[model samples]
Target chain A: MSLPELLRKISPTIWELPVTYKEGMRVPARIIASESLIGGMEAGVFDQAANVACLPGIIDYAWCMPDGHWGYGFPIGGVAAFDPDSGVISPGGIGFDINCGMRLCLTNLTEDEVRPRIRELVDQLFFAIPTGVGCTGFVRCSRSTFRRVIENGSRWCLENGYALPEDLEMTEEGGRFEGADADACSDKAVERGFDQIGTLGSGNHYCEIQVARPENIFDAATARAFGITIPNQVVIMFHCGSRGFGHQVATDYLQTFLKVMTTKYGIKLYDRELACAPFRSPEGQAYFAAMKCAANMGFANRQVILHRIREVFSRLFHRSPRDLGMDMVYDVAHNTAKLEKHIVHGVERELLVHRKGATRAFGPGMTGLPDRYRDSGQPVIIGGSMETGSYLLAGEASAAPTFYTTAHGSGRTLSRHQAKKMVQGRKLLDDMERRGIHVRTDSYGGLAEEAGLAYKDIDVVTRVTEDAGLSRRVAKLVPMGNIKG
Target chain B: MPYRFQDEITTADVAFEAWGDTREELFISCATALLRTMTAAPEQVAHEQKRVIRLKHEELDLLLFSFLQELIFHKDAHRLLLHADSVRIEQRESIFKLVATVSGEPIDAARHRLLVDVKAVTLHRFQVLFRDNQWRAVVELDV
Candidate 1:
């Protein structure tokens, strides 16, 4: 049967596949998307989400967000909360790049002030921030220091003059995950990631200069609260994670889990990528600690990248980052499995919420949000393709349906190969320039692969999230300049 | 000629199918495909450095997975863009062991038109099959 035929519509935006839809399902699988979005989804997405429902101790519903697409094991935008005692922790639920996320920094400069110099800004950024495959970072540190950096995350950046105190407050988990032990990480993982702190790795990762036009501000009061008050304000937003370090961590644990998941734990999986161990087992605890280390490394990687952005802007604009009002609005990780307290069936329980390619949209008054955002809710940054615009959103109280999680980005609609066949990289560069968006990339082939047409409509994604009551749109950000790796 | 990219199999990452007359040739074909994913032109990577790798696994497919992961490790840890020069796989009882010689140089951005980084090989639909008297494997990379 077709996915649409098997799924029962719960609402205009919510669709559910009953547990009977597939064997071994622990609970129903839900997809939160508009009809149009749901209709366009590939069968692999539904199959993957259903596969997730079959995992041990998955509570409530297995969810696929508006940006859902087929991933290796769990669908991109997959979310599920697993019980600590009865559940399992799978690397596939967290992704290869631990804490791979979005960071938005607000600036006082207007498009008029930055547009004329867009080429220079992009060029300087491309130079200052090492990008592409096998790129090393600018931060020089010993292995011992690197251990501390991974353990302490953005806190190390603060002490080393790369981050301000306020930046930590604005970052998720105050820029560090507790219980991160460097000992839990493999030396191979450490070696692979230690030198990648300030570098942006290749493939769909970017740093963009975007403008918030007066017309695109959807909620002016909330936007003002998030420090996006200026009309035509140019903000710097970047997407990356812990580079090679996180990849190695996930890779190591994946193999370890695969070896023991069935023989040692008797856990059966629909896919090998979904291999997992009992959450309370020795293997699982060690992986949790190691994953936390990678998460911290991701935080530090972006922190250092933020420092470079500050340095370049200060040098070019002849003003300190602080003087230019270049304060971070927020940094959020989409790929993570974090423990949080949530009310399930009228009982408050601590559950490990795994949000892969999904954002935590904690509503107003929810715990973990900073006091400054206590009333307005957490800021949710949904990055779009370079040609299309991105959105700034706020969590809504109405997100209780999906554990306060929402879509990450305008998810891909085409494969990279398919995208490359549609547009030439040189032509894309020239076209973007002609359209007033300056771009600098490490490889044109890579650039062509990320052509905007490769992704779903960002506007539609934002509308679906809002309509589904997962998040509310605050402002739309149009790119002025971009640096792609 | 031994490998081709399977564009339709994955959306966010890259996938390919490789075949060989023997398991050794299959490993080399898979290595070549992995190298091509990271660089538009893998032949441009000079064989200035050489590394020998030996690994054993109880399963044939996992042996292939470990072999590819070793290449990714060198790329991440040492920034080397390597390709397998020769591979030999032997089975003893239920265990499969692989020994290979790989060669490449540290990636020079000026010399190589690098593509996206292949983060890790995925076990999703990962396979090593002996079909039609030829050894074949299907692999997907998390980019």
Candidate 2:
């Protein structure tokens, strides 16, 4: 059904699809979009959100962020919280890139200091950081070390001489988790993760040189808090995740879950990708532990990549990364499951939250947050479609209705196959270059699939993510040079 | 036939694409391509195991994403370096099927190490197009 047909007017900004609208729907489906924006649903974006509403124990409405798009089970901009007792956790909802997220690094170098050196810097980074499909980085570890890496997450990076103490302090989750079991992961997943740590695998995973606004001049106090500097300063921002290991964990468990979903649990699913098992079941616990391992590996991956970026910059500039004032602003998880507390039925209840293709936007003073950030709300990062501007946002109290979540990216506007037919790889690169955006990747065919036109306008999406009270905008970043996977 | 590297449109400033005629062939070719990014997927495994996974439309895509994700998972999980032996895909009314038999032993110090793991198959520029009756799926997996 089309968007207009699917949505029911609830409030001026809120639209709902009642539970009776579809079989197996446990709760109503709500979308926060304007009429014209809802017209864009030929994309069938709301279908996934609708399927999400069918989930057992789903609380409130399974919401659709304005940038909503069709995805596996949960729509691209989906938000839902299931009851801990009866709720189910599905791997598809968390996506394969467990904790795949973005990191912003503020640099002391101003734009003028790097304009002439941009090309060389970009090239060096491209080389220093292995990218493109299957690109691996420099950390070669023994199996035991790899296990510790996964069990420890970003803390592993701190232990491995890759990050500073402050780096760990600034990262979301402090780069580690409370419950990760290395043994829960399969041998195959462990093998894939060992040496693959600290690499930027391709596809939307990128390391871009972003420029802070020239006139808007990122707020000094806020910039200082984030480690950013004066006007026209250059920063490196990138998004990536735990590579093969994480994928294996998700794949193995998804198959495992599908094998017993209807038979063992007696739970029916509207979508197979939403295949799930009880959160405390043997299979569920195993997947959760393994997923945690993948999440930690991802933390280590980003931590190690940060080290490489620092090394590359230091080598080229003949200065230390510290001297250059290169520091991590923050790292937030975009995918993963967490056990947390929320107000349910007007009573606080502990719950397992699965944020797939979404970000955690906890308001100030929530548990699970570090002490320093308790007052300012969780730092939320919203990655835009590559051709657009990505934003740094903070959670607002108004997001209580949203379970403190926000849109993950400027969600896809078109499928990759649809985009490739319209633009050739080389020509598309030339066009991006003509527009002053540097592009590099292993395959042009892959490049065509990722053209920015394939995604919704990020500016509008971020505005809604904020206007809806999910996450408020802090800063907008424009890309300069990028190393594609 | 050699796998061609595509340098087309910018793929999120990170990923790129490559394709081949057959599923097994693309597996081997993409393996070679990914290894070239760093090391290689190696050849001639001492043993092989075939697993068949059937899934619904949504799980099917996730299954496919996980299949490659598993290879990368194990490459990191058990440190096993594998070479693709075979891969076949079949579609049903409400189900899609995949059968892949891959081989390799645990990744050892003696074996060469290459690139990082490919996390999942991305929806970006992803398609399984059968043009001229040649079965070809062009997808850019997020590494």
Candidate closest to the true structure, highest lDDT: 1
Candidate 2 regions with alpha-carbon error over 4 angstroms: A4-6, A216-224, B1-143
lDDT tens readout by residue for model 1, A124-173: 99999999998999899878899999899999999999999999999989
iRMSD (1 decimal) for each model: 0.7, 7.4
lDDT of 2: 0.71
In order, the Cα lDDT scores of the candidates are 0.93, 0.71
Residue A349 local lDDT, model 1: 92
Docking class of 2: incorrect
Deviation in Å, model 2, residue A335 alpha carbon: 0.9
Q: Which portions of model 1 miss their true places by more than 4 Å?
A: A1-4
Query: Can you list each candidate's DockQ?
Result: 0.87, 0.18
